[model samples]
Target: MAKINWKPGNMLYPLPAVLVSCGNNKDNYNIITIAWTGTICTNPPMTYISVRPNRYSYNIIKETKEFVINLTCENLVKAVDYCGVKSGKDINKFSEMNLTIEKATKIDAPLIAESPVNIECIVKDIVKLGSHDMFIAEVVAVNADDQYIDKNNKFHLDKSNPICYSHGTYFSLGKKLGTFGYSVAKKPKKKYRKK
Candidate 1:
């Protein structure tokens, strides 16, 4: 076995690649691909997304105090990367990328119609970090595509082929091993037959 030492940096990989939509209306909407997003709390449901201060969508969301976190799938990989690299100041992302802006149930920012799941959030606070600003938001509503729901009323989000950001690449979600709590859960014993 060999060992090596490395400088500290952001080595956390396999993060949720989400398209955050923010603007006053559909006419001025913009989508910014973000990997620095995650759930923060459970009560009242909160999440956080880190954005650079100079990004186009940053000001829009800061002023509006609302945005939609649309989960990206393998099908949206192109648009997702495009949105991240390009600035809204130069182009109309929704129209240029052929994305639809559906009305949000509880926010000004519209949801991405192509996304399988749209999470509406209202920014509760903003923390200024060195490189990026973190927008801590409270989840207002969640809209899921009806097609992903099974006949049993269970939401099959895993079947959507979700995409994730790792290092600098995008990847489709891998196979599932077991449900939560399966590791320590006791297995039922089988009845023995007379030999």
Candidate 2:
């Protein structure tokens, strides 16, 4: 195998493309597509999203200290990409994209009604990094679409056909392979009964 080296940069590919909604009310509500976001902790439940300081929604999120991460599905790719490119300062994103705003439980930030999952987070801290600033937040509430939840309440997000960003393109999740601990766990034993 051969490998080529390039300049130091963000080469981490295949990241979840999510719509991050912010602002205190309908007046300033905005959505920004973020690929630089993920879970950072489990105990306290933390996640982060990186955005440039000049972005229209940056100050809204900074001042409010809260936002909602709307997980994007295949159907939301157009809106997701549009939100990424368009500036909230010029147009109303929710209206332009036809995305509905639903009230969140823990945060005042509105949730995307059509999103598969809405994760409400409170900004715990902010880290200043070159190009973008990282907003470290504690997940306060999570809302999953009722359609993705089963009768037993198990969330089947895979069925939603979630989309991810790779390089410069969007891709859908593929078929099932194995779940957590499936390789290490032993199969259940069958019991024999006398006829």
Candidate 3:
């Protein structure tokens, strides 16, 4: 196959579409849909979300220095898109979207009750990039819906049918290819039975 060179740009697609909740009080509570977010560290549990400086929730999160990243699923696609387009400054997103606000344990920001997982974070640093500012935060707490948890304590995140953003459109995750490290994993040997 022949290859063609293209201009340098953010080609990374299929990113998690999350609803980031911010504000310290009920009046200021707001939600901003974000696709530019991901886990940065595991040892201390860190994550980052990038938002334009002009975004309504940008200053809310900056001032409070905390936010909750609510994982989006198929059921939340409409609300996610609505929150992304509408400015929180002009309207109350939670009420308009018909989403419930569950108080977070370790942070002032409220969690989206409809989300399967809510990750509470406290801003550690702010990196000002060109178009957007990146908020680097430490994960203070994580709340998972009890319904998604099995008796074995395993979280069925896939069952939630999480959605992702690719290029300029949204898509649902496809079928499971395999579990981690399945290629090099050892296979059980065949046992001989008594003849």
Candidate 4:
């Protein structure tokens, strides 16, 4: 095998492209598309989202200490891209993107109704990293589109065609290969046919 050396950088790609909505009031509500976010803990249901201090929504989130992470899908690619590039300080992102603002149950931040899933989060801590500040939050509530929920209550997230960010490009999630523990599961046994 051959390898090439490279400088230290953020090489982690294929991250969830989520629209983080923030603000305490309707006048200041805004959305900022973020790829730098993920679950930090499972038991406590914690997550984190990194944002640049210069971003318009950054201050809103910091001051309010609350936000909603709206999972993006193929249908929201255009709006996601626009929210990422445009400044909320100059314009209302929800209105500009023509996205519906659904009321969050646990938080004041509005959820993107078009999104398949909306995770309501309350900031627990703030870590100032270089370039971006990380907001570590506890998941207060989650809202999934009823259409994607099965009768068994299992969420078909993949069916929503979730989108991700890689480097500077966006991509849709591919086909599922296997479920967790598939490698170690016991195989089915066959019985001999009766003569």
Tens digit per residue, CA lDDT, model 4, 78-177: 9999999999889988888899989999999999999999999999999999899999999999999999989998889999999999989999988889
What does candidate 1's lDDT look like per residue over 53-143, in tens digits? 9999999999999999999898999999999999998899999999998999998899999999999999999999989999999999999
Candidates 3 and 4, the one with greater lDDT: 3
Q: Alpha-carbon error at 12 in model 3, in Å?
A: 0.7
lDDT of 2 by residue, 89-190 (tens): 999999999999899998899999999999999999999998999999999999988898899989999989999999989999999999999999999999
Candidate 4 structure lDDT: 0.95
Q: Which is better, 2 or 4, measured by TM-score?
A: 4
Tell me the spans in candidate 1 whose CA falls farther than 4 Å from its real position. 193-195
Counting clashing residue pairs in each candidate, in order, gives: 0, 0, 0, 0
Q: How far off is residue 35 in model 3, in Å?
A: 0.5
lDDT of 2 at 17: 97
Q: Summarize candidate 3's per-residue lDDT along 1-195 as a digit string, tens digits.
A: 999999999989889999999999999999999999999999899999999999999999999999999999999999989999999999999999999999999999999999999999999999999999999999999999989899999999999999999987889999999999999999999999999
lDDT, candidate 4, at 66: 99
Per-model root-mean-square deviation over C-alphas: 1.3, 1.9, 0.9, 0.9
The model with the greater TM-score, 1 or 3, is 3
Assess every candidate by TM-score. 0.96, 0.94, 0.97, 0.97
